[model samples]
Target: PGPLSPSPPQLRAQPQGAMQVGVQARELRQPMAMAMAAAAPGQMVMSAGMQQLAMLPCIDVQERAQWLQEATALLGAEIEMANKYRVLDQVGNQFFYAVEKTDCCRRQCQNGLCADCTSWEVDVLYTPPGGLMQKFLALRRPCSCVCCCINRPTADVIDEATGQKIGSFRDPCTCCSLRFQVRDASDTDVLVVNGGCCCTQPGILCPLPCGPCAQVRFDVEDAESRSTVARITKRVPSCLSWFFAPDVDSYHVTFEHIQNPQWKAIMLAFTIFMDFRYFNVNRNQEQARDVLAEL
Candidate 1:
């Protein structure tokens, strides 16, 4: 599949509840050290330990917002999904992550609060057969970007077992379109995200006639080669669903055809980053106002 622009490809169906899926997350004590010790330059090696932790295969991930108030009550931000969201496969095997924000000011804030005004922390975990949460990928908002709106900040993707960074979500220019670059620890490019339904003009809202087609689409591609690997499509809701439940945006991500296990994790992180940027930057609010005013 290519980018969604030239010709849109048929996307995969969204996965449902986590109750039906069986998920297991193994601890990676020293993922970086093991990766270094196993292979020489120009060669990639997956040790037995890595193979154990990388048990989850590539698959479509579905993320549906629980409710609008539930999100604002937690962080006071205009975010949609601020609680724990589960990533499940077709059969219901699930992995989960909790989105948290800290360093909040006690007084009422302007624009947004918590992650919008402070920092965000995401905890990646998976439940084993016995139902205990195992930590996997941990991410934190970059310090420089937490307070500065002009600076495009990145969220460091850390390996919980070793407490070392394994990758990062690189945000593009704040005035530019909605796009992101995902890179590994070595600063090697992995995935490039080009989000749709975006207004390229800075400080301007989405044009009037585009409201009916206000679906958000993300084209995930190989960063280096620029080949399409996956796609995420969020549909435009009906009029009532839009006005009454504006924040509950559900995204559908497809990655079954992809073979790389690492890519799956990176894509999942990218998915979270998409929401983080959308709410933090106030794009969602702008779009909502535009659509409603037009209506």
Candidate 2:
């Protein structure tokens, strides 16, 4: 059994070192907490956002493999789902997480002709899977009229913390193929995203790699010389069992040379925009078209 509690008289006779030992314990705890706070992000598989955004510059196919961040992304913002994505690097380290944001009212309004025609504004928040979960980017895609794909569509990339536009991606309204002019904060065109289609009617998904044998992709070109600098290619999802799981998508984004992180983020947003505008309508009609067996 432990000794009984010391009386007041016994406590008065205690050594000064005993009192100091008690004080030292509490003081030691403060620094330990600070160290833990500083080390929390280091525990992730590899750093997110920073590492992926510093895209590996490659002039040939050999260097492309290392830079491939094959994202598992979702689609159908214009259809039923709002969409979500878990962007992963080649080695499966999560680069970032993205989820679509549309007002409940706006989502509910997505019905009838308005369903396919309404280019309702959709926002996507980009954040890491763990740690502080602070938003890295906020993407706002404005609505576009899709009647025969003649309209110009645009998306704005804003700094999550500051709410200021870092850059923008806009279609220059090409008639034969799909095209976009990626501009920086100063509105100077930095990159061009170009795509060719099998059908003459382009835009929508036409600007994306849409040939039967061709890889579904968009070539990121230099605005000045129209040189191919990067490419965003859509990859099929691994799980294909769902009849209409209202599937999401994934893409491999690569750069021949990229100097800015903001541009990388902006280009990523364009992939999601392409999915919603082009790949979404067909799946949306399934609810109305499916043959019903009386259950």
Candidate 3:
């Protein structure tokens, strides 16, 4: 007991870089004796070695590996979200460009070649979603003529047998008329519902009376090859009824009006400027936490 109190060996002061060297050795798994020997001569290495040993219980290798894996997966998800946002932003920009370029009404058709401009009666028809065949029809007057004489322009969808009209386009035009049918999976039947002379009486240009305009037929093969189907005729009059009348054709305008609100909201939500703020804020928060932890 007397000699036991002689005490442990006096510890020497640590060298200037001994702490860094010990940290490196711990990370590299060098033998303890070799690491202590590598320290500067007369430097007390026991405290550094003891400190590293004490850290071993608190250093969770498994937890760190799990954290790295989670971080990688989160980064992948963020990148995917960014890509989707980019695509949505592009679509919004395109829609804005289209709206900006479109002309308002009468401004679109200053030239007598109303053919150069889109008509109010015109419609872009495509096969309803989920339909078998994809068909698009741009139906409008063949010529630029306004019809004034006809009192009652009507359309009658009749059963092929007995010539009975089933459904009709209510408003009739004296100058031009159009009707379309998907004849089969591969063909379409286009009938000139009405025809009139292309008179010089000029209010709206009318397609001059052309013979039954032939059965303006279209093949699905042609449509698939060309990607478009358009027909212009001037036989029907450009009656105010054509534009203002409540009829099936008016459905085009109605559909456009109905879709406007939903489309506008969708476009606004996906804009890049709107998304950038959230992305930047989240990134800054993550960086701040990382810095604090490192410190």
Best by lDDT: 1
**All candidates: TM-score:** 0.61, 0.61, 0.15
**Candidate order by decreasing TM-score:** 1, 2, 3
lDDT of 1 by residue, 1-295 (tens): 1111111111222266422212111222223542435454544454332343356444334444446543343343553334345666546765554444433341123234544444567787755545666676776775453454566667777756456776678776644466788776665555677764345332123311135345566777656545566777554445554444443344567763444444456567667766656632323555555555687
Per-residue lDDT value at 228 in model 1: 63
Per-candidate count of clashing residue pairs (backbone under 3 Å): 4, 3, 30
lDDT of 3 by residue, 145-182 (tens): 43454332221221211122112222233234322221
Candidate 2 clashing pairs, residues 3+ apart or interchain = 73-249, 74-248, 209-217
lDDT of 1 at 232: 71
RMSD of 3: 38.5
TM-score of 3: 0.15
Could you tell me the lDDT of residue 241 within candidate 3? 21
